[model samples]
Target: MLTQEDNTLLTRTGPGTAMGALFRRFWQPVALSRELPEPDGPPMRLKILGEDLRAFRSTDGTVGLVSPRCPHRGADLFYGRNERNGIRCVYHGWKFGTDGRCQELPTMDSGPAREKAEQNVRLNAYPTREANGFIWSYLGPPGQVPPFPELEFTTVPPSHTYVSKKLQQCNWAQACEGGLDTAHFSFLHMALDDGEDATAKLLTKVSSNTDTVRWMRNDGAPRFTILDHAAGLILGAARRGDPNENYWRISQFLMPNHGLTPNAFPGENYHGQCWVPIDDVSCWIYNYTWNPDRPLSNAERDRFANGSGIHAEVDAHYIPIRRRENEYLLDRNKQKYETYTGIDGVSEQDACIQDSQGLIADRTTEHLGPTDMGIIRFRRLILDSAKALAAGDPPRALNHPAAYKVRGGGAVAPATQSLPEVLQARFGT
Candidate 1:
């Protein structure tokens, strides 16, 4: 169980809190590409990762994220009109651009007086960028925000990409942790289809001091080359005739509030989607369908649409605002959705497990060992750096880039496929 102090570290979104500080270091997705397909109308209101902000594309195709409330009378920016150049606040006719710089004060005389005041007062605006079919915003300190990583999935042809979204009620951290918990894949996504499946169990479990537990590639390869890690992370490069093998699986967490997991199909197809949080407790999972040539098979496409399979029923009853407080206080506390399957026969899959675990986990009480390496390291980075930022220190990952080589540090490669000989011998297909 997490103590009050532990909760303080995890739940607080102030400058130095564990999760908040960590999230501030990256450029997070604020909205989907379709949100601003055209440069028209009032700005779109979006709350991404955790911050409340407004977004809109310019007539010239540039997207901007700015403060939601007017710096003057505190009017909401969503109601403002989008002109060719900037957003004009209907409340006071104060106009501003994507840069958060005040461009005009219609009521004031058109003179240097208005220009001086506008120059002195600037509304907070976050840096915005678009990538992989999503609008991304950097909410952290400008200097510390890291460059987005260049994953191999993005290099594939546009025909391979696909998109989709789902709604959840939970904090961004709770949602993100699901992706890092590699143990759950075998249990949650239980290999109901893989031909050479090793993890078909109904439930997946692990411990810190793993001896009997095998964590390695079946080939007995070098530790660094194999997907052998305590964190349950399995990665490998693409191999010919492999089970949709590629340089990477394209599964990654955007930190704090969002994650991306790409699933590949047999027809040379791929789908990259994102799980975006609606608030501290609710999220919207989105999919960007990248496939342009071949259409998805019925079964393959259905897999993505099944709604976190066996988990949706439990999520229906979740009320984040009410349960948020008690979540952090209990251990072994199954989220309300974790156990609540609707009479219609559905179970809460990933969403319930994380949220019900606690709105915010008491990290100190977490018995993290190896399987949780990714999550553990991620949290530490978040808390420590957030603490540093709170202390007015520079943010970490300030020089983050989209593409960088991972040398000798033992990164996981994508999964491989069973040989044709084995398949023929076993099934005679």
Candidate 2:
């Protein structure tokens, strides 16, 4: 458990905060690429890391992330007209380009005086990159911006990937730690009193192998082995399997706030999530399911679109249909008869519990055990990185962009085999 001071250091990520500074150094997904479906489309209202911003797709198809308020008269850019190649504030006909520099200030005549005022009066803008259905922006010191981590999902063909984002109404750290804490899968995702095939029935869409489900159900207490790497940590949890074999669920925790789930088998879809903080109390969980081997089929895509695995069924605004206001639509009868939590979807179950940990979990009051090793290391990594950045040192993950290409999945190996050997046998890393 963290002390009160350490907990504060971990949760608060507003501007000027140590954690916020560390997050800003890395590229963050500010909006989905599809949000601004076309050039000169409406701008998106964004509030990331406690900063109000706006995102727009320019005529060249490049994305722009800038302060929402027009510097001219403090008018909100959400009401601005996206015309030509820039956002023109209707308040006074002030046009700002994707770079946030005033492109045209109609209030002043087009002359040396106008040019000087236009150049001097500009909105705060950050750099943006569009890849794999996301509009990512770098919001740190211009000199300190690192190369984007080429996450495997973003590198795949568009047809092979399905990306979505849902509002997670809780602190970013707790939701993130939930992803790294694979031990909860044994209970949180289990179907209670549903006979011998209960586990299989519940996780059929998540894990193709029924035996893997059985292993997860039988061994609630998985032995963990964590390995540190350039991008983040490789968390390996081993559960007892049939005979001499052990079922290993290996996951990846990338940098400050990304987690790759371990449910995929060879030829199956790989899944990951990025918890980009909207504020200290909430975050947008950007989720992706990608097949590295081939394109996703229409049926598979439809299933995901309707809510399956990590994908939640969200409304047009990207808010989950089953959310906090509705108590995640809990059904006690279903809890007693169907699944353990009475929650219909895996994503909803996760959200229901994480949000229950208060707006922010008070780590100072909790008890932690060995199974929480991944959670512990995750906190240590980011907390330490935050402190190190404060001391004028940068994180090592920023230097190894290619390391983000690594994958996480399940494997079956001898109980005597080490995690390294299992990783080799499964992924040939």
Candidate 3:
């Protein structure tokens, strides 16, 4: 368990906080690219790392993420007219370009004074890029921006991916830790068929085979092995399988906040999620599924779009239909007969439990065991990085962009094998 001080330090990520500074060093997803829809469309108001910002696409499809408060007279840019490549403040004819440069100071006289004002007045803006289906923004120090990490999902063809986002009503860290804690699958995502063959039909078929289901059902406390690398961590949870084999569920945790699910095997679809803070109390979970060798079928796309795997069935606003206030539409009968959660989707089951830990989990009171090794290591790595940044040392992951190109999934190995050997046999170095 963490001390209260460490717990507070771990959860609070607002501006001026060490944790927030660490987060700024990486590009963060603020919105899905499809949200803007077209060039010169509606400007989106967003809050990331506790700062209010606005985003708009220019005539050339360049997205501008700028402060929502217009520099002149402090008018809200949210009500601004998105026209001709800039947001024109409706309060005045004042306009700012996607780069945050003042385009027109029409309220002033067209002379030296107006020209000077246009050059000096500016709005806060962050560099943004579009990839996969996300609008990723860099909130770090200018002139020090690094290349975007080559997350495999972004490198794949658009046809090979399905992306969606849903609001998770809990702290980003807790929601993220939920993804890394694969041990929970034995109970949280477990169906009534512990010994039956029904649950063997893997939810997404990444971790398939009936023997795998029996292993998870029989072994609640999987032995944990953590491997640290340039990008972040490789978390392997090994459950007792038949005879002398170990069923390993391996997941990846990328620095700052990304998690690759351990459900996939070779030739199967892969899944991942990014937990971006909406604030200290809530976050947006961006979910994606990809097939490396081929384009996903229409039915697969429809399944993901309508809540399957990590994706949640969301309303028009991206808020999960079965969210915090509604108790996740939990049905008592389903809990008794169908599944342990009684929750509609895997994503919702995760949301329900994570949010139940409270808006911010009180880590100080928790009882952690060997099964929580991933969670413990995760906190240590991130907290250490945050503190190290405060002392003028940036994380090494920032420089090793290619190191992000790693996969995590299920691997069954002899019980005698070491973590590295298992990793090598499953995912070659």
Segments in model 2 whose C-alpha atoms lie over 4 Å from true places: 195-198
Candidate ordering by TM-score (highest first): 2, 3, 1
Alpha-carbon shift of residue 306 in model 1 (angstroms): 7.1
Q: Sorted by lDDT, highest first, which candidate order results?
A: 2, 3, 1
Residue 303, model 2: Cα distance from true site in angstroms = 0.9
Q: What tens digits encode model 1's per-residue C-alpha lDDT throughout 174-282?
A: 5666754443443343322232222212222111211111222222221111232211222222212224432222233433333333223223333333455555556
Instruction: Report the candidate with higher lDDT, 1 versus 3.
Output: 3
Per-model TM-score, in order, reads 0.63, 0.98, 0.97
Best by TM-score: 2
Clashing pairs in 2: none
lDDT of each: 0.49, 0.91, 0.90
TM-score-best of 1 and 2: 2
User: Backbone clash tally for model 1?
Assistant: 40
